[model samples]
Target: MNALSVIDDLKRRFPNEPEYIQAVEEVLTSIEDVYNENPEFERYNLIERLCIPDRIFAFRVSWVDDKGKVHNNMGYRVQHNNAIGPYKGGIRFHSSVNLSILKFLAFEQTFKNSLTTLAMGGAKGGSDFSPRGKSDMEVMRFCQAFIQELWRQIGPDTDVPAGDIGVGGREVGYMFGEYKKMAREFTGTFTGKGYEFGGSLIRPEATGYGNVYFLLEMLKTRGLSIEGKRVAISGSGNVATYTAEKLLSLGAKVVSMSDSDGSIYVPDGLSQEQLDYIFKLKNIYRGRIREFAEEYECQYFEGERPWQHVACDIAMPSATQNEIDGDDARALIANGCIAVSEGANMPSTPDAIREFQKARILYAPGKAANAGGVSVSGLEMAQNSQKLSWSAEEVDRKLQDIMTEIHKQCVKYGTEEDGYINYVRGANVAGFMKVARAMMAQGVL
Candidate 1:
């Protein structure tokens, strides 16, 4: 596959896109050996085709604020691939949203969807419109405006987008409303919808729960149990909150949770009451992590992450990408951490991932570990099509089963000769093979 050469060509073609380049480099490096083994793939020139998106929609989202002011923001949708099925991914709405980040996310989603054993391809879209400190009316108006430019490009059997950072049920609801009015039909155009509208029962908790579920399977391989394990989790949003909820129920001690403002640590681990308070604080009141510390009398580190500050047996990076670097990885390993299950996309830098792999700790990448959300989103599409809803228990059971299967794939492909499970290599290769075969059968465009 000439991995280095392909990367060099890409860097020149797509300059100033560190995140996208990093993502492509990682996947290509991992699958180079397998890709080169099959000459048919090269005959189709599939690597370059797979690396670029099929189409990207870029437009301006114009909305009016409560102050009667018009605001304009750039919005984008990158349809990376739809060879296997319809395009599927999430819409992020953070201020940090940019072409590089969205392109990287869409690239990663291509493989993540392949691993789910579901008929879904890959895409991603979002705007740089931050909802923080914005009024409900303003947020709704912005969401509606954002969809105005994207409604024509998406559909139930075409491309379905859920939610990601700075996007939630409320935002989805607003977008769905606008889409319904624009498209003149009601369909499962989006996942992560309000349950009353068509959202799956466990959709919100899927990613977080799936991460813990994957972690459990990893632990099982080593004859380890989650009970009594001290956990340090970053981020206090849906992923981290539900992860802590599931962990507490399974008898794990969660000692830390964080936000963009900082991290809070409870030496004895957070109780159900404490986590509930955090749920209200972050979700309902939209407060910061410092509020959790102030309310519970715990230590709060301002402008810091939880990895190096808190000692634990496990570290889950549930926040944004690159939140953990080499230093954080070393601290976690030195602090007796044995596993890292990512709840956020590409949360660990390359250097940090290398450290985790070198330490031989149980590490699951975000694509494999955090794929539950999209898994259930796929389920949501099924439910919407069948005009039926599954019970909470049914959805949860399916989620667990999906996670177990993903772990098995990682074990089958990622295990090194030295007996260390290189999950990164395993997940990348496993996901790539599925997409590669589908693309080959479909022939080159």
Candidate 2:
């Protein structure tokens, strides 16, 4: 009846995918006793069935390029759960995505959204379509075509998907416009829209900002602050940039950031001008990280990960999943990395997580750390439902509140036998309780 047993039983019964099972096992092993003690959840067999999705949709997305050529990609939608509300998650466009990854994300999202105290269930969908090197018109056309088939399976109050890797505001607009044209219902069908078109102003910066907010809370508990702390951030995308910005505003010196290729380190702390240049390179010009080093007059290491560069007080992994492995974790610990907060889904593998916990570093999982994105998405949903938009300051304040509340809940429920709080367990248990109660209240379908 323990949470570990619940996941272990799934692993045994399934006995098909070892990696996936191990991932679930790591999460469950963190909070096994809670599941064993919860009578309502146990009575419903929630733990055993929580890992399974309700429906999985797969389709082929074939789009023609401007050069009279056709390309086909596989798409997936995993509706992990909907007991509390509709499915809500992001669609990632990466070559590495598959059914297993999407299912893991959805399962994690079910808890992540619940932790935000938002009435959103869990689901994720995307294609293995790489948007890089494609023309704007080409990407738009693909998005339009992608949504054409996906429209039937989603709606405002049903399943809402936002953008992830290889997808952005333009793609969201194309998909939203297509969905509206097809359904003839202009509702909050999708989030991450442009601000003028029902997107929340803070949504773009929410995940990064939220990760820092959670970190600030963690530091506060230990009577520490981000002041003068050296921060090393991975990924030069929206999450990493905004996270570094927030940390900089809090008086922390951000020393390094990376992309897929390599990393850059500046001794005098990164400047806003450099970040503006980075945005132009990545968001506007779609350039690489090597260019980042050239413009900033910094040291660049090609074919090297960010964690191995140098020491820092805080480490934020805003990059893709499994970016920080055990080696990276050990390096961070050795280099005096005090806090590790994830701005991307499952950025740290199980081994990395174990290393961090063993080192007693303040660690926040992406589900809880990055909840700010969907938290603002929820705010967007409210604005759409009420036909009103709040000011940026108001939205940002609310976001801080949401992140702080999540931190409190995690700490409240995640206390370990040794009095050390495993944020992963705290996040999962806090989220699970809310969703399970909601599901129990709704009765089984």
Candidate 3:
């Protein structure tokens, strides 16, 4: 039951993968105590089995641009595990794609998938093609090429990829088209497709909605509510957008939202019209977050980061990994930031997590907090198989229910005798137990 021993085992097993090691290190630390209390986990050697992925696939992708030029990109798929079902996660098309990052993501996805109580496994794949300023034709070509080699390795019953950062509905559509053309069959090979296709409702907002729903459970456990609570969210993507929508719907006042460029503060809650415009700009137009401040009358900052001198009751880091560092965590704590739940993957660094735990602030990891998207992706897979589609409200209700259940599991397993919830421990233990049992049953696959 020694966490350090498990970490040492992982360290030796994965010497070349610092990112994977870093991501799983905290979980190992928490696993020691959980395994001590629950003898079955340690008896089965679950930690050793779950630390490494089943397979890692990397391919070279070459495509031509509009200017009579060819570009080469690297595509990777990390199939973390397959005990429960086929590999399921998002395909992110961004320049930042790397094996280590993908491995870390896939590793986290194993537990995230288990937390959803779904029959999906863990996998993530993508390329290094940055879609930021690419023309539509260029994107289409890139996606087509990316899927050409990928098509052979993926399928509905093999691995289903959704969309992630820099990969929106546009990218999903392009990839799905190519996949269909190459595979010559219409199946749920991908989730997060356009609604006109087989994509399920509420997939776009599921991650954000799930995050707030999980936070709501945490708040409710502490006899608190979101009503009239000033909140700061640090993203403008699908996850951030729907989170904003859900927060507003429940009477919470969102003070600020941001993107990679900068964050903007609107003392008054963002109106529906403003939210609509921002959604169009980011989701459709591929616009930037700073435009929200320029187009609307909100307090704005440029060429900088968020977590400045603002004060709020809750802070949601919806942007990329490590956006909230130790200093940002201190700033939040100083400004009465009582809770933080990540909407983006690894949004908070190790130091930021320590700061929150030191101050006894409610904190939830992205794996558990932002699991709604894949949960709904699982729903989409179900719809595809059953040939039945649910309404947005139905999907949203399921998402809320799953997220609330995850929070309760975290509290039930992670709370101290004094009722202080350590969601990190709770999520790690709860997610680990399911995956470990599955792995043990499967016998070393």
Candidate 4:
């Protein structure tokens, strides 16, 4: 497979979809050698087939506000692939929800799910309805309307949607309730549901905890540990919150957390009190990071990211895509930062990733690092199917085991002659091989 030719064609076909093009280029470039070694893959046109999604559902979601104002927003669901099992992914509800971003997410999910060793395929859906300042009723109405458009496309054994970005337990609950009312069934059509319902234990904390676990494995490669490490983490959402929680318990000093508004740097590290406040502020009250800075009297950088300012042993980008650019990567490397494990999807740009790879620092891609949420989602499906709920300890044990296996797979495929583990290459190759074999066995669709 000629990676450049395929990328060029994709660029021509999807000129406006830079994110999608970038995602395709990354996977195709990483898997080119292996894909070429098997001529049958080329004859079957597997690369192109995998680049495009199996189907995409676009629709309009109309909801009413508290003042009886009718609002309309675009909604989408991209089912990327189902060669392995049923479709599975998240529903993001940020204003930035576009086809390009969802397409990239679904494409990335295809491989991310493959790495989990779970029987799941790849899919993603969301809408442009920003729930930032909306009241609970407004958000609930929007979620219900959003589900009204695509409820028929998802089911317990078909597609299971979870939470992402702006979607959370509350949003998932609203959607699931609407679906249940519409379909008259109480099934696990959605993961990340409220614990009172059918939500799995530790599902909310899975991504963050999984990221830290993957970082632990990476640290073990150098005979190091997370204890005593000063860490700088971005974002104040579930991923960053639980990442800091696990890190604090492991004795790591978490110095930073941020939001779209800005970042706060706590030079002395955050206390449990501070983290608790943040959890309430963001989750319950829907407040900002600046509020935390004001309460804790920390240095807050408005309209800026936390990467260039925080000097720490580790940097966890749990924010958004393309957040860490080339300059941020160079700053982290120059500041003697040793490792970076992403808790968000595609948080680092290609240039930033190149910087980390050139520096030989332990850098884990989001597909492998941030896959914990979906891993637990797959487990939730299992528990729901059996009509049994696992204990928190049991679920956490399974999550840790999955992360360790993902790391071992990365090492097996990504280890280089220089004794450096290229986790990005390792993850992509390992994930691709699994999906490719499955697709091959199923024959052409």
Estimate the TM-score of every prediction. 0.99, 0.96, 0.95, 0.99
**lDDT of predicted model 2:** 0.85
Model 3 Cα lDDT, one tens digit per residue, 1-445: 6767777877786677766777888778877765677677677766666777788889999999999799999998888888888999988888878887888889889889989999999998888889888999999999999999888888999999999988888899999999999999999999999888999988888898899999898898789999999889988988888999999899998888888788888877777778888889887788988777877757777855567656889988887877888998999899989999989888888898999999998999988999999999999999999988999889988888899888878988899987789899899889888887777777754
Worst 10 residues of 1 by lDDT: 289-298
lDDT of 4 by residue, 319-348 (tens): 999999999999998888999999999989
* Shift of residue 91 alpha carbon in model 3, Å: 0.9
Candidate 3 achieves a global lDDT of: 0.86
Give the lDDT ranking, best first.
4, 1, 3, 2
Query: Which pairs of residues clash in candidate 1, taking residues 3 or more apart in a chain or in different chains?
Result: none
Better of 2 and 3 by lDDT: 3
Cα lDDT tens digits for candidate 1, 1-445: 7999999999999999999999999999999999999999998899999999999999999999999999999999999999888999999998999999999999999999999999999999999999999999999999999998999999999999999999999999999999999999989999999999888998989999999999999999899999999999999999999999999999999999999999998989999999999999989999998987887788999999999888899999999999999998999999999999999999999999999988889999999999999999999999999989999999999999999999889999899998889899999999999999999988878
TM-score-wise, the better of 2 and 3 is 2
| Native RMSD of candidate 1 (Å) | 0.7
lDDT of each: 0.94, 0.85, 0.86, 0.94
Give residue 57's error in model 2 in angstroms: 0.9
